[model samples]
Target: MTAFVLVAGAYTGDWVWHDVAAQLRAAGAGAHAAVLTGMGSGAPAAPPGTDLERHVRELVELVDEIGDPEVVLVGHDYGIHPVLGAAGRRPGRITRVVHVDTPLVQDGATALALVPDPAVHQALAEGPAHLPPPASREAWQRWGSTDGLDDATLGRLIREAAPQPPATLTQPLRLTAAATELPLTGVLCIANGSSIATVQSLVELGDPRFQALADPRITYLELATGHWPMLSAPDGLAEVLLASAKGEGRRVTRPAEGELPPHLRPFLLDLPERRRERVGRVDLYPPEADGPRPAVLFVHGGPVPAGVEPTPRDWPTLVGYARYAAGLGVVGATLDHRLHDLSAYPRAAEDLAAAVDLVRADPRVDPDRIALWFLSAGGLLCAEWIAEPPPWLRCVAAAYPILAPLPNWGPFEPRFRPAAALGRAGNRPPIVLLRVGGERAEIASTVEAFLAAAEGTAADVEVIDLPGGTHGFETTDRSEDARRAVERTMRAVLDRLES
Candidate 1:
């Protein structure tokens, strides 16, 4: 049987993995949950001084006891540190490593480095070694991403949680090149607000805490649930974990049109014919017209790592935009570029070029009248095309895109700098900016800078400020304000394409 070892975060014990362990066992695997030195019934009187080495040693010992030549190490939250450290020590015995909503710490770095804020770090550091459960059931529900926990599960969880050692949070991780060589997967819980947006910013900033994820061997898996998937989404988490262990998590397979949300069903159409093999896939939405018709390529913003495969849940907004374009009598295709961290940059541009070529060659598409609609990070790919317009490329639309990079996230690439390219471009296709009113300060500033750069350009530029709409307003926010912005932006794009 396959051996699976599970580790829980600080202030928690093996009980947190009860459901996942059970699921693993039923799937014909030998599952074991490691109870750290100062946790649970293992040693109630043990002080909170249990440090990193103890936890790593305990994990290594557990693997030895399992008597398996290899095992998959699954860690939740802070558990990632010890699990990674143990894996480094016994690289040959660790077949795979999985981190659930926890960033990997750099060698000689404390896991607390992953905390986004220093205040949170201070709180965790000064707290009692074995932190107590939330004061009341209501507070527990209100705590970070635990709102999804049912009453029964919450009760069991409250009873089982033990105060963790403060040393565990204080100790730094010690890992070498060996840890990076292990097959790694990150299961991000989106409901906790740990979305792709957060990961993108981290990777762009070159944050050391996320270095492991940025490596070529790591695959990203997303769960749209809360922080603790074991209690909130055990079955789903189990399926992903099993897939990771079987080394299938990185394989890319296009989602069937039927598998998409009901609202996206009507816009489905066959892909454009290609002479040679294509670099990426596109979800086509042909217009209702019989003869050739004007078409638009819809690109969604994502800093999906270079080699990692994007799951269906990864880009739902792109589907919404493609369908919206089709509704306006324009053929639309949503393209998925190479997303791995190793291949995303210049590769995305190549993919976009290939997509444009495919659409131009399609008999159903009007090659000379094609337009480009880019959203978020997708705008980065448009710098070159916009700077040097193709005779057939019509207009270009950028919706709440980060036209420039933030200090935290440096430039994507020198050529991918949209703001710089805007100033250098001569007369080209008309450009439209769909500015969101409620965008975050940093991103909004970048958009503002781009708008400023476009002011003196020879190209005809238009900016429509979408009032009361936040970032991703079209797909994520369902308010009347968001609805109006979507309608206005689509109308703007349609007018430009027809003009």
Candidate 2:
């Protein structure tokens, strides 16, 4: 007796949900495909004033009219905005809220802010009041992956798609506390680069922002299809929705209370602490007998939540490595960059460059003998330095880094791929790579690709493999091999710095 309200993302309408709705109805559930104010077959061209709030009102009115005793609300992509707003207004009536292949956007966040493409940003900012839908397959890929969709469905989508109102993208979504309190389900599109494992990894980072995702009330289901699952796998999407209503999807496990996540655990190597000095946003651990010694700048990986406490500079692994480097007769520096999320890479790269400048300018460090060490997600930031090494730069090092964007990280700039950048280097600095045997397949594949790209390059590429290590192995593995790998990698970096 549960009634389902289905909402489609930008450029589509109720038509996009037709197959799913039919399947839902055949299974004895009531389904309503919502047609927003500026979309669908009979609707007029979106007016200048058509915004998010207008769409919310439309959904609210539909829910009121349906008056089903039990109601489940489903939202896909851009459709999540109105679904959240409407749920906020009618919290008591909504049984559960399902997010389909979209991020859980916070209050007052605009879709424009979450999108990573600069071209999309420009189009929404300076183009027409209503942005037109994709005219071809290439353009569609920019919006989301087109995997699993046949040519007929792709053509139908292009021909029937509606123009998106600019205000819908730019306007902020407002939500109430009661709405967030409702039971939630997330249907992740794995082929589009997100899966239950990805969500679980984020939760394991111990970030407060992702803590709520571990709550038992939240469930996750993986769809091995493209972003538009309703179009590509309608029956599967319908089944998932039904399962979601029954609270049957997998739940992400949290660390036991008072226990730290693996990344936050103490570093495996035991090293004496050195006197630490703070320089702007950088933390310096200068060697005791330093006479303008060679420096190694450590960059921590993220798309870490901006609000996460202790920050990356203070992470046990970074702190431990910095202190250990100081013990080896070099100035070791750790920096706090602005890589707060996927979209902030450019700003994060700029912050890292500035930190390098700050470190080189310090009187205790040798400006011409600096080495850069990158970790985890921070690995992509090394692409620029590798592509065009500065005369003063001596070496580049990365540990368990993502060298290429994941398949699901849609429409990324080609310049950020380290594997591709290797081909563009003229006088590249020596490269030291630390590969983990037990790393996630997605990340491990990126490292393998980078290695293949380095096959015949003039650069001196040395790889130190940890046979039984995981990503963030310094704290997670805690084995003899892990300690030795860390030591070997550090020694290799020092060799390049002192050369």
Candidate 3:
């Protein structure tokens, strides 16, 4: 029988793998769910002193005790850290490494460093060493049921979930190129179609952590479920594992021709009118019409990754939104701003200004009928735009934008606060806030704060509540409601410019 060692991610334990393990066991394979020391029930919470080496030792010890000459190593979430480290330490003893949900860590970098958001670090510092689930019971149920996990199963999972020691995330992994040479399979969960696109894009861009994914020995599988496939879609996950055990790679189901509506192709790479800026490039997608078209300058979220060059995968989203706008009858242009590490707040604000000037100067664009579409973190840079409302600007649209600073995002300049700007600007533009209904608590608070500050201000603030929309609704949520919300948002922007 082929032996499998299963490692769980943060706030999880062996119990989470019970269903998946049983399926593998019934298939005549010996499967052992190795609960990391600081996770699972009765396990001592790992302290700040606990590091990746500690978990590496535990996994290596477990493999030796399994008594199998070679084992298939499977890791989920943060478990990828230790699993990869162990694979580096004992390459010959492992047949294949399967990573689910989380990417393999880069050498000399902690898992925490890879997370783009600063808020996550804040939460870790303020909270307990072992982190618990952030969502409520209802939210968990809502997010987990993408694969139809029943109420009873989800409840059991919630009850059994534990606090993951923060140390697990903060500790850097010790890895060499040897692990990349091992046969690898990636079982992607959550928004599986786009997730595959993202992974493939990362591979194409030569991201160090995902560079192995491009290797001929690596295979990709999509579970089409939530992040926790073990609890939600155990049967599907187990089947993938069984096939993987035989060195079989399942064919990824490709999206049908034109399945993604034409309107959603605003950020298509093939869009015309490209120019290079100092920080990055900007692509302009003009309306198909002949005369001067109303234009909108788009800004993407992220202080993305520091020190890494930007690639198509870096801003597939902003590219898409820009395409969507142009397809709807306006000149849509997407801007790639300098990363936080390379440039600070005002620099991004300056880049946005330059993109606007470039788009306005275009003979095909109407300078008087321009607007701004800011997504996520990019919305923060719009504080200056809001504070000093331009005369020709018609409106400002933001989708799930982080309007307020939780600090630590450089200087909290007055321009960082949009609400205050809305109140002071003599010529406030109509603002359309695309609020995601199912947003998390922290983001929800930021949204409410922005709205409250905008109250009684001169700005004509309009809130478009996208029911059932996730954080990155455009790319992630394909529900009818979300699609309609996106369509409505584009029409509003185009109509404002055209009028």
Q: Please list the C-alpha lDDT of all candidates, in the order they appear.
A: 0.70, 0.88, 0.71
Model 3, position 219, has a per-residue lDDT of: 75
Q: What is the per-residue lDDT of model 2 for residues 1-499, given as tens digits with 9 covering 90 to 100?
A: 8899998888888999999999999999999999887888755667778999999999999999886788899999888889999999999889999999888878998877655455667887575777878899888877776778999999999999888898888889998898888899999887676778678879988777887788888999988788889999999999999999998899999888898977788999988878999977899999987489999999999888877778888889999999999999999999999988777889988999999999999998899999999999899999999998998899999999989877657666776889888999999999999998987765776798899889957567999999898878888777888999999999999998888
Q: Candidate 2 or 3, higher TM-score?
A: 2
Better of 1 and 3 by TM-score: 3
Candidate 1 residue spans exceeding 4 A from truth: 41-44, 115-130, 136-143, 195-214, 251-499
Tens-digit per-residue lDDT, 266-362, candidate 3: 3322345433233245678777778888888878765554455543223556666666667777887886766454237778787778889888988
Q: Pick the candidate with the highest lDDT.
A: 2
Give the TM-score comparing model 3 with the true structure, all chains together.
0.60
Query: What number of backbone clashes does candidate 1 have, counting pairs of residues 3 or more apart or in separate chains?
Result: 13
The estimated TM-scores of all candidates read: 0.52, 0.81, 0.60
Candidate 2 minimal-lDDT segment of 10 residues: 111-120
RMSD value for candidate 1: 14.4
Error of 1 at 336 (Å): 29
Model 3 alpha-carbon drift over 4 Å, by segment: 42-50, 114-120, 123-154, 192-194, 205-211, 250-336, 339-350, 357-367, 371-498
